[model samples]
Target: MDRDAEKIHHDDSISHSQREASSAASTTVFAADVGDRTTAEGPYPRLQDQKDDVPQQTSAPAPPSDTAPQRGKWQKAIIVVSLCAALFLAALDITIVTTALPTIAADLNSGAGYLWIGSAYLLTSAAFTPSWGKISDIWGRKPIVLLAAAIFFVGSTLAATSVNIAMLVAARAIQGVGGGGLVVLVNICISELVSMRDRGKYLGYVAIVWALASAIGPVLGGVFTARVSWRWCFYINLPITGVVFIVLYFMLHLDNPKTPMWDGLKAVDWLGTIAIVGGTLMLLLGLDLGGVSFSWSSATVVCLIVFGLFSAVLFVLVEWKFTKNPIMPLRIFKHISNSAALGVCFCHGYVFIAGSYYLPLYFQAVLGASPLLSGVYLLPYAVSFSVTSYATGLFIKKTGKYLPTVWFGISVMTLGFGLFIDLPSSPSWPRIVLYQLVAGFGVGQNLNSPLVALQAMVKPPDIATATATFFFTRVLSTSISVVIGGVIFQNEMERRYSYLRASLPEDVARGLTGSSAATSVGILAQLPDDQLQIARNAFYESIRVMWIMYVAFAALGMVISVFIGSHILTKEHTVAKTGLKQERPVAEPTEQERA
Candidate 1:
């Protein structure tokens, strides 16, 4: 009887051990599957626990289950359309006011204050972008985007109804706050919805909307100013924004992580925000005012430059040491890929903006085209940019590589800018258009690649912050480039005019030296034929200098792009394989189970 009992007991013990082994194996498989899904589908990086049978929480919400209802083609189409419309509205607002400025100045009798109409919007937008990005990460994307649209709508209404220039400037600043957020959040939202591999195609579509808006904005502004009222420029945003808001409300669905309000508040780097905003404002103010409103040596400009530099330094320190949650995380710069990509982005902005701003000057001041005709002449750039952007996106989607494409784009841009130096005093339309097309194609190739490369380098949670930094750098570079280009052009024109002044009539020399001679084709047209020819020659030489500067910038971009670390663009949204380890607890057996 005792031997039989022992045999049964041993058999039961063996059965229990087998059951435990099977359960452990199944758990290991479950964890592996979860990890795969996290990398393959999650917007943020998956927590990688080293211990067996340990549970980990992801920084971002878990990705939707594969079995979850997938969005149909039509549903995705609606979402894309809605996003594009919102993007168009934001981009249009930036340039649409260019032609309307004169009408606005006349209607409001703004005089010198007219400059503030554009300055206020730009200043507030640049300062507020990163902050808005951080906020979106903490709160949620959809709510913040809706809030931005609502703020933009209110600003538009106020702008349309403003009785004085002060009110209008105020309204524009308000609009800028919303506009800044819209641009950043839209990109983030798209990153969340699409896989990294497929993201470029959708980004290409966004680029199309942006390019179209940029091309059409001035034309629409002219129509409104001439046929309707300048107020329509502001009023038009209302209906578009309303439609976008409605569509977003219905179609956009995202799972936002919930954090306590106090925790969210504590997570913000308030000091860093203030320092950065103040620094950017001061820097931009100095750059904007240096040559136009005040001399570079003036006390106001000097003080602003110094203060801006000091604040910037302080901001870096705060981000590095003082803040627990940095507005611009210092660690992002640790990756060579990110640092190099940002450098390229800055140089790209400088070259692109310089081209955009100065090409029009060449058309109007040197070529003697009318304002409307000058805008029409820019069509080659817009169309080629759109085409190449879409094509490059498709190429990246297929190959899952971006660095080589970026290198090719920058090389082409450098070549194009180099060719601009050969522009004749009176070139044929085809010659100029072909030059612009080459540059535009180059611009399109890499315009969206930096963002893609940046997104790929970081974990998903950092997408918004990284994007905001990219944009802030680009914006800052553009503002500085425009100012620098203006300085170069103005100084060169003045120098050339001075040399020519020795032989010309006093009146003609003085007129040629005036600011209007460099900006207004109408003023150039009124000059005597002899004086007009001299003015055109002077403008041509100055524009050539600007192009040479652009060449240098484009070349720098190409060189910097070489240092961009190559990574296999993964379809999986995993943390960058940066050799960082994740910690997790190991499951322990209960005392009864052990016994």
Candidate 2:
């Protein structure tokens, strides 16, 4: 009876051990299931990276929720078109305003105060671009972009109703706040919507929008300012902006970013913002009217120079040491590639400012073409830009290398600048078109390549900073370039006009100028033919001097381009916390285990 009882106890022990082994196997399998469930429940992995396979505690703002309304195909298309229109409008404004400068002044009966119509808009737009981008990153791009559109429409409304130059300039500045949002936020949203391989295509689309707008802007401005009224140029934005606002409200629901909104807002470096706005305004003002508004030695000029310099110093200091978040974070220069990229972008922007302003002069002034005709003449430029942008995007996808394409694009631009440098006092229309085509082709290549390169170098942590640096450098350089070009043009024009001060009729020449503000082309257009001839000569020669200065500066961009770091592929950042995280260990149950 004892032996039988022992046998029964041993069999039961063996059965219990077998049960324990099965339980362990089930737990290992179940652990993986729990991990899968956790992953399934998590928010967008797009916005976060886990360290040590543990999820990050903080992340980018959650995008518009899963509960947010959805859109149908037609609705989505309309929203996209609206987005494209808003961007195109912003770009168009930049080019269009220049074409109508003379018309605005003549119609408003304003002096050089009218130059601020364009300069103020530019400064204000560039100043707030980074700010809007950061805000969108926190609050959501849709709201910010919409708000900007509303503001732009209102400002345009005010501009159309303006009774004086001051009002027009003020309205333009207001419009800039909205314009700034559209131009900047559009790019940010596009970055989020596509994969790396496809990103270039979307950016190209933005460029296409810009090109189309840019291509047609002067023509539209010419038609509007000439036939309808200069005021209509401002009014046209209303219906367009309204349609955009409605479309976005419906179809542009994006995933909510995971970054903290409040944190990002608080991170905005206010001091940098203020300094940039102030310094930039002062510099632009000083440039536009330096020779005409106030002599270089006058109190106004000195004040502008001093104020701009001091404000700039303060901005740099604040960004370096004091700000919790710097608008143009000085720390972005920590990477050599970033610094080089900035240099290249800055060169590009500076040259663009000087070129955009002066290139049209050759058409309108030298060729005696109407504003509309001049716009038509500029068509080849947009063509080249569009072609190069599309071609380069394909090259990037296939080759995964941008250096060669970039080099070719920049070289073409440099050659164009060289051609411009050699452009005589009067050149044939073909020469003008040819030179423009060269520059445009080069610029098209550059438009998106450097940015793509910059994005390649940094992780998401630095994306905002890198983005800001890219745009900030461009604008900052532009502001400086405009000022420099202005001062040179002013001095040279004054020197040329000095020939007339003593010889011309006293009535015509009397108080003809006092450095308060020089007579603009519009104001000069009102002068008698003989007097117009004198002013035009000075204007024409002075404008040439500006282009001469851009040649070396624009060419310098290539030097910076050559130094961009080796091509690095973007890959996954966060690791899975659980998985076949490890293989289960098998137990050896002694020599008889297999049985």
**Highest TM-score: which candidate?**
1
Q: Model 1 off-target regions past 4 Å?
A: 1-69, 258-263, 514-517, 572-595
lDDT of 2 by residue, 68-180 (tens): 24446576556667778889888878767766888889989998687788877887887676666445545455676778898899889999999999989989989888897
lDDT of 1 by residue, 44-73 (tens): 321222222346545954422222225778
What are the C-alpha RMSDs, in order, of all predicted structures?
7.0, 10.9
Q: How many collisions between residues are there in candidate 1?
A: 0
Clashes of 2: 19
RMSD of 2: 10.9
| Candidate 2 Cα lDDT to native | 0.66
TM-score of each prediction: 0.86, 0.73
